[model samples]
Target: MAVRGAGRVRSEVLSKKLYCASSTPPPHARHFADNQCQSMESFFTRFKNVLVLVAILLAQTIGLAVQVRRPVESGAPDSSKVTLIRYWAVSVVSPFERFFHGIGYTFRHGWSNYVDLRHTRQENHDLQDQIARLRLEQASFAEDAMQGHRLQAMLDFQQHYVSTTVAAQVIGTSGNDLSRVIYIDKGSKDGLKTDQAVITPDGIVGKIRDVFPHTSQVLLINDQTSGAGVLLATTRIRAILRGSTTGQILINNLTPDNRIKPGEQVLSSGGDQVYPRGLAVGTIESIKIDPDHQPYTLIQLRPAANLNQLEEVLVITGTQTTLSAQAQKDLAAGVTTAEAQAAAKQIADQQAAEAAARSAAQIVADRLPSIHEGEDEAKPGTAAPPATTPPVSVVPKPLPTIHSDRYSPGATPSASDLKPGAAEPPNEKDLN
Candidate 1:
């Protein structure tokens, strides 16, 4: 009876376990499960926005990283890797920019013409006065230049001659104050190259930083990375000119002991190999000792070219080496060929005049009355006798020589022989 009861209990337990495993849940448990599912769906729906924002930020960060990363060897940014976005943007927007530029140009052109016509008479008068002044200055400069040419010839100095240039219109600027760069309507197609000089009649503006197919960037002298070899126009002290973060240009590498004055002109030294020697750079504004960097004086400069307001510029496409041989031949005798010819003619004329003078003087001497050397002298109260025939040979009278015995070793000479009339020394005031 006990075994039969245990078998019945096991069968009942198996049946309950099977039924519980297969049976559906009660209403409260089903509700709880449904609520948890709804919460998960809602949480994921909110997280979608966060994920989108993260994706955008991540993309921007990557782009920025690409832009900032550069080849470690050279500080210069690899131009080949320069963002094509800039080129595409330029290509798309260039037509609009050019249209606006054209409009501005037309208005400016008309207004300028009207104003020019209005001021023509006054301008002409002013120009005449300016021409007069320039003429006077030019005459002085011509003389000075002639003298300089002579001196240069003597020193065998040569000058670099600009062989070719292409005119370019200033189209726009980089619009970044830190860069201080400008763009022109010229590029590689126009023979523009990186590091070529840009200038105007007034002074040097800058140099080509980057060249594109149809445009180029010119870095002004006030950019921090820009440097130039410069010379003090007055002192001729060579130094490196650099730009500072403060937007000021400075003549650097000068010792603290160096003397610098305000308003002293600065010029390109050509040591940097961009600008030709003697191009105008700027003028000194102030000088002070740098406390942070000892033994160096800080010199501030005001650029000669108005870099901020550039409208037109000249691109130096090429240069020719000045042949020393030509200059050597042309500058012979420190004068121009025409001047040398004139000088030669004048010297020849002077020689001819001197020869004529000597011949005339000889003829007059020959015409004078001849007197024999041995003829007796007439008495003071009697008439003088005239010479009839010339002597066979005329001998000059011998000069009297005083022997050393005339003055004994210890004896002092007479006053007539020792004393001479004192003449005033020549005045050097005129020469000075």
Candidate 2:
């Protein structure tokens, strides 16, 4: 009785551990023990059920053999049994097929895999597009930063020059044909006006030829009829610079008193109130003079601005010149009627010269002497006397006559006087 009581206690303890997970009173332990006994009873019940199924199979062996033999012996009639077997087989197979099909393990597996690959590819492409856009944004930011630096440099330059300045970008340009002009964003609204000086980092670029409300047109230093007073940087000698239509700006009529030389630097002489003094014009490329006018030089200035390549400029304001219509709003700033008429006449004359050149070419090809014309067109350094002029006798002047500045006295040589065989003329250069 004691051994049986100990077994009962251990069983109660196990039941309490499984059901309550804590200490339990004796009365509840009795109920949990009852549940465990009932569970054991149900497990034995399932084992008996399996034994009963084996017994039934053993009893039906003869009947099942008969059922199978009927189908093997004849291919006819017993349709009910065949139908029953087919239904059973289909029921079992259909469940397995449906389950495996849900798993996608059979026919469309390759197509499903292909779809997955394409989806992944599209995602990768989207990611790449995002990266490319980010790169472009970075490049744009770098460009903006560089443009800001350039603008700051321009501002610093404005503070250095002698003017109340309006800095402008060279936004638009006419082609190399017709006339050389660039459009600036500053106009009459920004205190810019016609005849205002346009300068770049290097030196003079042009002048304000036209002014609108928000923009202005600049005539480049290369434009015909544009003139400035320039002096040699080496000698302080002064000369008038005039732009020719053929891209050559000549310093004309610098008299016997003022001498210009080759390879001398030239700058503004401060003679005019328009442009400030000491703005670079250009270095003298070459000087030509005639012995008949032995003291003056004919200088041709190449534009210092490189007008073909300027990108930014400062429009000088408040240096003693202002526009006529500063207070007139909504008005067109333009040249006078007389100036317009003169410009039209100049254009007409250019056209006429072009036509005459075409006619002259025709004449030269027909009957004129090409050889004689070539001699007449020779450069000053290499020119030879033409056979057309007679050999005239000349009396020699005295050696080294000095009391100069006496003959022409402040009168400069003209372009015609710059033919050839001239003495080294007085150079319009400053004393370095």
Model 2 lDDT per residue over 136-176, tens place: 45444544544554676677632123536788866566555
Clashing pairs in 1: none
lDDT of 2: 0.63
lDDT scores of the candidates, listed in order? 0.73, 0.63
Cα TM-score per model? 0.59, 0.35
Leading candidate by TM-score = 1
lDDT string for model 1 (42-149, tens) is: 686679899889999999898778766543311133345553666676567656666776788889999888765776889999999997676555544454566776
Superposed by TM-score, candidate 1 places the C-alpha of residue 348 at a distance from the truth, in angstroms, of: 23
lDDT of 1: 0.73
Model 1 TM-score (2 dp): 0.59
